[model samples]
Target: MATLRGSLGEANLGRLVVLREAAGLVTDLVGSEQPVFAWLVHALGSPIVMGGQAQRTLYVADADLVPVGEVPEVRLRMIIEAQNETDFDAALAEAAAIIDVKQIDDKELASLLEKAAEQAFLAHSLALVATPVALREMGFRSMAGSEEALQFKRAHAGVELRIDATADWLANWRLTGISHSARHAQYSEKLLPNEVARGKVFLAVLQIWREAFGNAGMPECLELAVLYERHQASMNRIHVRRPVLTVDPKVFRAILRWMQEQEHKLLDPQGDVTLAFSDGLLRLATGNVAYGCAAWGDWVDDCVVVRQDLLALSGPLARARQIRIEQAADHLGINGLVLHRSPHSIVP
Candidate 1:
């Protein structure tokens, strides 16, 4: 970003002056206040950037996207267009950038950028889906999907390790999506939210490029995540207890049916029906009770009981309210222990 800031932006004038000074082309600025000359020249001249639809924007190369039209020829033509300018070196820089962008003329450049952008989008979306599952398991919640987060639910042995191709692809796609998303963040207030937004978007483009190009710069998302967690230890150190949900998996099926049938009526009492994963079962913790959501541990476990922990939040009284915890439990139908309140107590 700092690398491509000068050439096509408002600072291009100052950047040019600095470059001239560096080349010894300007003699009067013997007392210049800044030494942003050499870096400015190099930044502008780097082949990684292009002027965007907006003035301050710097469009960079996308490795995942192939040019819609003939890119190599377009690259050459880009050189020709900028070659006739007074500053031939600068023209060469701009030309190289155009080549890198795979956009200089008609249908070709746009096509490539778009194709690459779509690929980037897929990668980002995949990453987004995978991350929340991981985070939810670890008793964590993010404001939004972030590429840098290593924070995960406390780990235990009871969880199923089944990885779906969709989930995996979704995770990677999400990483790309976030990177691409960041580039568009500035276009709106709610969209970008913060610097992290743009970083994620651009980072996806970088990731896609890396798949083809040799590894270049890494994304800042990773670094930012590490900093945010303040992790006192390595990922291996986090530990959590596992649950015994599949002792009888039949109840799990009935619970699933109940939930699907009474979707609106059941879940209204529960606040968003949040879950915490503990390897085998997911815990729905409220003020008093923690309902363990049971998924069938295996194909043979037809006797599914959703982790056996709904007694505390159920029964006729619990379900009486239009929006009560019992109605939510009816959907989960998991069989588990409950910590109940006392009815008769004699206090001194």
Candidate 2:
């Protein structure tokens, strides 16, 4: 591990300096050991008029070693007269880039550095907010249940959409599960005329948020309304709608049991088993062979013929259940899918 430390400052900005003695300790051990360890700290202090100071640290060690609980070897102190949030962002980006160029080589090390920077930036930004914001104030509230659900409310907001994790919620809405489609006409005939509108709005809201944040975890709910407003125009253009299929609870449960029984045969082949609902039938297919059945009172009618030679189930049965739950959630307008096995329920 080679550590580098330095600082820069401006007249109105507070002075910036590096703890050279500390930095030298880590830099000296760079190529001499099998597992290298480096620690660096950077502090940025602004003038009284610009609000106080913020400190951030970066630490990196070999993946296999237990890290030492000691003070960092290198420390860089910075003071800048940041006029606004943009200035602070620019300064942080520059500092992160400098660290990236100097000591980042391992992928994990780089990720740690990035995470530290993001945390510091978010902390500073949140600190600047004069009034604290709550999720309820932003028209978002969690429902009272074991499963997480979000209720969005706003005047003239079209409809208050309550997104749930379980298939039972869809029953409450009188809607069925559907598959993804590239064309709108494919699933239009199956859904009610009013449902199409509601589903469109629901899906559009989800799509906007998904596109903006991705799987990077939840963002601060305070800014959600602004994000929705910004993306509203574009969301209206989403034409492809997800298909919905109605299934009896007993039938879905039976399918789950059958899947559990054939878990080894379904997963052993290493290819994804795609379960789709269409034409009043639930179909599970992987590779060449396909299976279909219609659910009627806890049992499937017209079960697919199985060729013993072609069936080879492997892997954990829980995985297949998870996939089915996830698919159901996706088609049923549920977000943040979490399948809990102990209670055998899906939570969001």
Candidate 3:
């Protein structure tokens, strides 16, 4: 999360420093007047190339020039936070100044914004892990003997939040609708009333995120998945959209407040959950019925075979209902229909 100062060309060096740091490498800004070539080899212990453009000098590692592999696929949609608001704002201002959005075409502007978001996400994730309490509040327990890895517990709604820099440096968080059974060791979609009564892990984490993100006012898209059953367990995709490219701070605050206040209703099957923005909103549908058939026989003529196929749900209501049903099943264990197919395809 190194902050870039000086001109855009000078900022390129800061970008390299941040990239190297993100890759778990040590870096520092050094004077260009010294014997940079000898210093790079003997002091830095690496071969580096020094180049100048328009009187501005740049130092680049020779190893960095070598191809590592294919570049990681970029995700346009992401939820990110600013580690230091001042530094984040300065970096963004610098990017905007360089892009000259008014003169640039839409495609170029889009590319600039997307790239900024990607960089912010990586910096924010790295900064977040520095504070152990932040990870704990987000329902992540550090993995044994590892600082860069974490594990999600069943009590945390089977939602995993991680940033893996080792593998292609692609970091992401995935939320799934499944939990393990502590007693029977059998995977269950239902929350078993007692589990729900114990602690509201999901609700707590929602508040933690809402507060942690604060009012950065950056445009963000949340990738949502809801579990449903026809004959087999499946996930219904929930699309979150915004009408405008830029989000107002007031609107962002409202969104977080709504999510925090509606925590209970969000889990209720009958309650409606909506994310209201300035010009657009996304609603969470709830309380849809599941239809399927179950049979019992042996391997050739065995029982306990359920076949539910082609539920074919569509629209926001379908997505919301599936999410609500899944949430209820996961937290409260309330939607356990005897004939509904189990989501055993995933063990954890």
lDDT: which candidate is best? Answer: 2
TM-score, structure 3 vs. true:
0.20
In model 2, which runs have C-alpha deviations exceeding 4 angstroms?
1-224, 228-276, 283-310, 318-320, 324-348
Instruction: Give a tens-digit lDDT track for model 2, residues 1-348.
Output: 222222122342333222212111122223324323332322234322212434332222222123223334322211222234546788689978977788766796679778887655444333211010112233444456722333443211222223222212222121222223232111111121111222233333344344433334433443433343445555667854333334444444454456556656654444444444556667756545555656222211221212221122222332333222223322221122332221222233
- Considering every candidate listed, which one attains the maximal TM-score? 2
lDDT of 1 by residue, 1-348 (tens): 122233234544232111100111111111234311121122223233233321111222121122223225455445435533435576568767978786467567668668876656444333221222322322323333643332212111222111111123212313221111222221101111111222243333333334423244433333323322233233336753232234223343344345444545543333233334445564544333345655333221112123223332344223332311111221322333232222222111
Cα lDDT of model 3 by residue, 28-135, tens digit? 223323212111111011112333322112233333332223322131111112223444687689867876856777798889779877655434333212122233
Q: Give model 1's TM-score versus the native structure.
A: 0.19
Candidate 1 — worst ten consecutive residues by lDDT sum?
16-25
Ranked by lDDT, top first: 2, 1, 3
> Against the hidden true structure, what lDDT does model 1 obtain?
0.31
Pitting candidate 2 against candidate 3, the one with the higher TM-score is 2
Supply every candidate's count of residue pairs whose N, Cα or C atoms clash at under 3 angstroms.
Answer: 48, 10, 12
10: Cα error in model 3, Å: 22
Worst 10 residues of 3 by lDDT: 223-232
Candidates' TM-scores?
A: 0.19, 0.24, 0.20
Give the alpha-carbon lDDT of every model.
Answer: 0.31, 0.34, 0.29
Q: Model 1, which residues run further than 4 Å from truth?
A: 1-216, 219-236, 242-348
RMSD of 3: 23.2
Which stretches in model 3 have alpha-carbon errors above 4 Å?
1-83, 115-138, 142-151, 154-179, 182-348
